[model samples]
Target: MSGERVGAAVTWGLLGAWVVHDLEELATVPGRLRRNVPQLRKRFPQVPERVWRRAETLGAAEFATAVGVMGAIVGTASAAGRLTGGRSGLYQSALTGFGLHGVMHMAQAAAVRGYTPGSVTSPLVVLPFTLWARGRLRKAGVLRPPRPRDAVAGTAAAAAATVASHVVARRLLGAARRTS
Candidate 1:
């Protein structure tokens, strides 16, 4: 495939992986956490059970919205890169961010010695897709091979976005609860 086509495929593949990963998390994460993470409630004693449940209920929506935002950013950056001779910093950042996210999921699974929320598909889907996308981006001259620092920074940015999404979700859920 041409560079632009490769980039577009990477973008779409990342989004698809995210949707599947989030669906896996939504289906199982809260229940798994309740069962496995012994210190969860103890660590956040201030959060009531009802609130926790509400957050859990909203998890999928929050994840979907965040992924959508990430997609828009990547798509816009990719388009710009195509228009401007393939200098897409945001696209590179996203590739690094998502690639590292796959690694994080694998690490989480390894630490627990079992399946964690997104673990089932992280290696099988996310990692491979992200790796291929990174390679395509490099071959296309849209980005260089990811560096350690770039990955770190990208992951940090992604983490911040995740936190922001959670905050927004919480507020929305809280409002809905109040109205009900």
Candidate 2:
């Protein structure tokens, strides 16, 4: 197989894998948080009231809007990867963040002592796909050895994107509420 073709596949595969993993999250997050946040806050009082309050505010529509915003970002990174043959820093950074996100989901589940959004697919799809794609990128000679800065950059990007998406979601919801 041509490496270029394989590289494109690897890059596009990231979006596909993310969609699968996030489907679980999209399906579960709003309801799960609604059901458990009160108990979770009580049980883990150190988690901060704002965190609990913010989580409680997430309705399905708001969460879906956030997912759509994040999808656009991921889609852009995947396109960059495809165009650059897996050599794009945007693609690599997103890939790293996606993998770390899976790890975080596992930890979230453990910390909550129960199922959490994305936990089902974190191991099954997200992490495995990330590792496989990274290996393929390495074999294609486009891989950069990760540095501490890469991890920090990836993590910060992920966190910032999430926050931005939520902000967008909230603004959209507010606008809709006003119009209605």
Number of the top lDDT candidate? 2
What are the per-model C-alpha RMSD values against the true structure? 4.9, 1.9
Best by TM-score: 2
Worst 10 residues of 2 by lDDT: 1-10
Q: How far is candidate 1 from the true structure (C-alpha RMSD, Å)?
A: 4.9
- Deviation of model 2 at 178, angstroms: 2.2
TM-scores for all candidates: the values are 0.73, 0.94
lDDT of 2 by residue, 1-180 (tens): 236444566999988998998899899999889889889988899987999998887899999999999998999999999999898999999999999899999999999898889999999999999999988888787878989999888989999999999999899999999999
Q: How much lDDT does each candidate structure score? A: 0.67, 0.90
Model 2 vs truth, CA RMSD: 1.9
Q: Which ten residues in a row have the lowest lDDT in candidate 1?
A: 1-10
TM-score of 1: 0.73
Error of 1 at 24 (Å): 1.2
